[model samples]
Target: NNMAEAIASAIISYKKEYFGSQADVNYDKTLSSKAAESTKSKRIADNKVLKARNSNVVFKVQFAAGNKKIKLNPSNFKGLKNVSVRTRNGSFYKYAYGDTSDYAVAKKDLKEVKSKGYTAAYIIAFRDGKSISVEEAIKL
Candidate 1:
């Protein structure tokens, strides 16, 4: 019975993999079947996470970091548009300019950001709204 349960689970998994979410499992009261259903659901969730991580990689030119929140306005950012803020911890704020997916464009924006007297401006990358290393962003 154990072997039968294991084999049934494998077949259900295979169907889910090849047929996508349309592959529905007929649930039974057995414990093994419930376990298989849980496993399949977890796999589906993992796949979704992977897809999200691989998409939406964006680059921004970080121009300021401080412990206080600055009002996000053109006057606050030396007239730079498309400025955004990412908060660290709870109170600390990092101000960045430009939203772009092109690395070359971000580098260009960094130059402009530095010209505005933010001499230490640098490029940062994010995937799925979480900060990621630029090197890792490049690989993604």
Candidate 2:
């Protein structure tokens, strides 16, 4: 189809017009507009994750809640990974799965989590990694 050649030509033209000589030197790295955009998006997402570690409010599926600490691993979590734990006053540990700011994504995760044998799993919200009501998280 020569699609790659066409895309390369387009990218070179775009760089020559918009970014000039310096961009031409880096043109091979970007390949196409979509690739350039994807790189930019990845950087943005990485920054968000860094920020989320400290201040972002996110929704997660709480699959296990108990006073005792259970080691987090695929074996412990029914072959599922990406698990995290939150505790209150060093008293109770809430084991949660998935981490996203999108409520819809959290809902979807909840459904999958239940299907994984965690029938009682539900969506929970956290602000700075502390438990908060779903309604409050949405408002924030």
Candidate 3:
């Protein structure tokens, strides 16, 4: 009988030390380190979403392209530091220019590309590494 009493006393003290004596009296006993960790994880996920929402919108001016290697060269297209030759849908070579997150800023860049002989240059946005409509990118 004495051994049983000592064990019970030890368990109660352990609970009080970890969960607090108030937790013992509560109807719900879900308070634990694991629950605290779950709350922290949810907060971390919410922070990521907020960061994505605040990210700058990006665009590029597609100047030229070809199903195969272009007759011309991308190196001679423009001197923009952000100019790049990217593969579209893994099929064609596309020469694009400019890097801006603002829509109005991209329009100004488009004008510059047009002046450089890329009259058909246009603005396009990307999301998660895939191209999307500028309208859609703005909405996001």
Q: Report how far residue 23 has shifted in candidate 2, in Å.
A: 63
**Candidate 3: segments with Cα more than 4 A from true spot:** 1-56, 68-75, 89-91
Candidate 2 wrong stretches, greater than 4 Å:
1-55
Clashes of 3: 0
lDDT of candidate model 2 versus the reference: 0.62
On TM-score, the leading prediction is: 1
Question: In candidate 3, residue 10 scores what lDDT?
Answer: 46
Give the per-residue lDDT of model 2 (tens digit) for 65-117.
55567899889988878899766556556678999987657767877887888
Of candidates 2 and 1, the better by TM-score: 1
Clashing pairs counted in every model: 0, 0, 0
Error of 3 at 138 (Å): 1.9
lDDT of 3 by residue, 1-140 (tens): 64475457447634443443321131123234323432333344344332224255566666555555443444566555567766545555666677666555666787788686665566666776676645455556
User: What is candidate 1's lDDT per residue for 11-54, written digit by digit as tens?
Assistant: 87445434443222212222355444334433443443222235
Residue pairs in clash, model 2: none
Off by over 4 Å in 1: 1-55
What is the Cα-based lDDT of residue 103 in candidate 2?
A: 65
Which pairs of residues collide in candidate 1? none
TM-score (C-alpha, index-matched) for candidate 3:
0.52
